[model samples]
Target: MIQIGDRLPEQEFTFITEAGKTTATSAELFGGKKVVIFALPGAFTPTCSQAHLPGFVVLADQFRQKGIELFCLSVNDAFVMRAWQQAQNADAITMLADGDGAFSQALGLAKDTGAFGGLRAQRFALVAEDGVVTELQVEAPGKFEVSSAEAMLKRV
Candidate 1:
């Protein structure tokens, strides 16, 4: 898990769209902005779909009011993430799929979801300003404790 004050990890990943797939790096997302990035184990899971992602979605306008951009990530492929986003009607959040688990691995936040058949991203929330992390919260697997959008919102 990353610690507060650490520089933001490289969060590059692919975001597949109907038009075609797109590639983005963390620098592009966080540079020149105060950003809130949250990660979940996978898209369409119990806690993630019902609670975690929706919490951020419902609060997106409030966060934006605070001058923060929102991003939600999962270890699934971008196509899956995109579909999930549409299902949930999440236009306020940028859905980034870390399909290779590269970003989570680089930040040491990947977890083994054996039954789920892959390494997944541990639940986490990070506050980054221009690509530097100012606050971080990494939750234990299956526990939706600290790394919540609301918790991070209070800190901000």
Candidate 2:
């Protein structure tokens, strides 16, 4: 699994913006930027929708005030991610689509859900500077805590 001091893997993520759909490389997003990135198993899931994503949405300004960018990633497609962002009123957070779970796999954070949802990202979050991980918080299965934005805020 990716850990502190490890650089994010090079990968492309699909993003839906006001302009339209676009692809951003990991370098483009994290290089020279202090970023707090969180990943969930899927979009519109219970904890993810009710608490995980909302916590970040509510704390986005604070993170930005601290010179950090916020990103929320999921194993869903770009369309689903876009919809979820809109539904959650999360304009302050950038939604990243790991459509095929490639990026999660690259980070060694991919979880095998079997028939439940196939391959998905484990619930986790990390703080990175200039593409290198500075802090990482991975949640225990079926539980939520350390990876939440509130928890991250205290650490970052």
Candidate 3:
């Protein structure tokens, strides 16, 4: 798994914006910025919808006050991610679609959930400054602890 001080791998993410579909690399997203990235298994899952995403939404401004750009990533496609964001009314967080799971696999956070789903990202959060990881919190399987927005708030 990626550790502190490690630069994030170069990968492209699909995002749906007002201009339609757009692509952004990891560097383009994290370069020269203090960014907080919270990644989850999939979009619209129970825990993700009820707690994980909502936590970030509630604490978005607090993270911004510390000059951090918050991004919520999932292994779903851009259309699903955009729809989920709209359903949640999460305007504060930037939704990132790792449609192919390439970024997650690159970070060694990819896992097979079998019957629950296919390949997906682990639940985790990381602080990146200028494209390098400053802090990383990866949750244990079926657990939610260190990766919450409230938890990140305490650290950052």
Candidate 4:
């Protein structure tokens, strides 16, 4: 897994924007910015929809007040990600689609949950300053803990 002070991999992420589907690299997204990135297993899963995403949405302004940009990433397609974002009313968090799990694999955070479905990213939250990680919080399998928005709020 990626560690503190490591630069985020320059991987592409697709996002369904108002204009349409768009692709951007990690550098384009994280370079020269202090960003809070949270990766979840899937877009519409119970824990992610009910708590993980919502916590960040609720705490969006607080993060912004600290000059941080918030991004929510999932190993789903842009269409699914867009739908989930709208369904959750998470306008505050930028939804990123790691459609092929390339980014997750690069970060060494990919897990094969084939029993449940397929390959997915582990639940994690990290603070990246200008593309370099300042802090990282990864949840245990089927658990939510330090990676939460409230926890990150305290840290930031």
Stretches of model 2 off by over 4 angstroms after superposition: none
Best by TM-score: 2
lDDT computed for candidate 2: 0.94
Worst 10 residues of 2 by lDDT: 12-21
- For candidate 3, report its TM-score: 0.97
Candidate 3 residues 1-156, lDDT tens each? 899989999998888876799998888989999999999999999999999999999889999999999999899999999999988888788899988899899999999888878889999999999999999999999999999999999988
Candidate 1 weakest lDDT stretch, 10 residues? 10-19
lDDT tens digits by residue: candidate 4, 1-156: 899989999988888878987888888999999999999999889999999999998889999999999999889999999999999888888898988999899899999998896989999999999999999999988899999999999887
Better of 1 and 3 by TM-score: 3
Best by lDDT: 2
- Runs with alpha carbons beyond 4 Å of true place in candidate 1: none
Return the TM-score for each candidate structure.
0.92, 0.98, 0.97, 0.97
lDDT over C-alpha atoms for residue 75 of model 3:
93
Q: All models: lDDT?
A: 0.85, 0.94, 0.92, 0.92
RMSD of 2: 0.7
Sorting all predicted structures by lDDT, with the top scorer first, yields: 2, 3, 4, 1
**lDDT string, candidate 1, 1-156, tens digits:** 567778877766787666788888888878899998899888998899999998888888889999999999888998899999899988789998888898888888888867756798888888888988898888865589787778878977
Q: Which pairs, if any, clash in model 4?
A: none
lDDT of 4 at 126: 92
**Cα error of candidate 3 at position 88, Å:** 1.1
